[model samples]
Target: MKKLALYLGLVILMFLTSCSSSKKMSSVMKTYEVETMGVGNDGTYLIKVTDYFRTSDEMVYLDGLKRDAVHCVIYSGIPAGNGSINQPALMNADTKIEGYEQALNEFFEQKEYLNFINSVVNSSKTITRLKDSKEYRISAVISVNKDELRKYLIDKKIIKSLDFIF
Candidate 1:
């Protein structure tokens, strides 16, 4: 009778230990919140994609075609109180948009965060071009699997329709 009781106690202990370990298993899902805005063909969009990381302290940029990673999360697009859309441009000229090529070069320097952000589809630079008496700002942040993105573009038929005008 004592031996049977000991075996039962051991079984109970193992069950409790298994339950505790199961509770400690972590979650596997990731989520990214993306937002985009376009104005006057010169407006810029700020996209924030947060995964398991809770803080928005860093952002990663990748060249659209080359797919190289860039570090520095300088432009998180956290809204400035109840300000207007042009708030990003309200800063000093030094803080304003750099020429496309210059911005591209600077962005390429931050390659350390690439593995975390696999690819970026839209251009990273805050580009300003005049069109029809209006200036447009175009920028984006994309957080997703690189392979999934290319496949998505192809599946949606958007990839086949565009020709590089640049």
Candidate 2:
């Protein structure tokens, strides 16, 4: 009985030591939100995306065009007519407009912007179509990587790399 108790105590002590000595791995995470606007054109819709930077209290403008950043490529496309939307081939001025909105959303949502900068990102996209025309307007807002932006500015001498850790 005494030997059994001793072995049990030893096992408990070993378990306690291992648990206390274990190390936690360090990691990084990013969160984001989005807002959107829609314009109707010939039963179709045009949407734009914009990212939100800091709260209204913080810096109102980022690099340019308010505090949010714009994307250079379109993120998605939807067709028009019959109130239905589809990602059809790019054609006409309306298609060009959609492309711009998509690009802006993509650029701001990039992990490099949010994860590296360690900023909570929010974005929006809206579309509005003319009442009696075949035209639609799209817009978007995106905010991410504020810290990365600051670091880049400080390191103006050298271009800094921006990317998500995970």
Candidate 1 lDDT over residue span 1-166, tens digit each: 9999999999999999998886632122213233332221222323333222222222421233122211122222323322324333111223333343343343345432243354354445343444553433334454433343333333433233123323
Give the Cα lDDT of each candidate.
Answer: 0.35, 0.35
Worst 10 residues of 2 by lDDT: 67-76
Cα distance off (Å), candidate 2, residue 36: 13
TM-score of each: 0.20, 0.22
Q: Judged by lDDT against the true structure, how good is candidate 1? A: 0.35
CA lDDT for candidate 2:
0.35
lDDT of 2 at 52: 34
Model 2 over residues 1-166: C-alpha lDDT tens digits? 9999999999999999999998863121112222333333332223333333333222333332222221211122332433443533222343232234343334355533333322223444344555665544333443233334434323432222333212
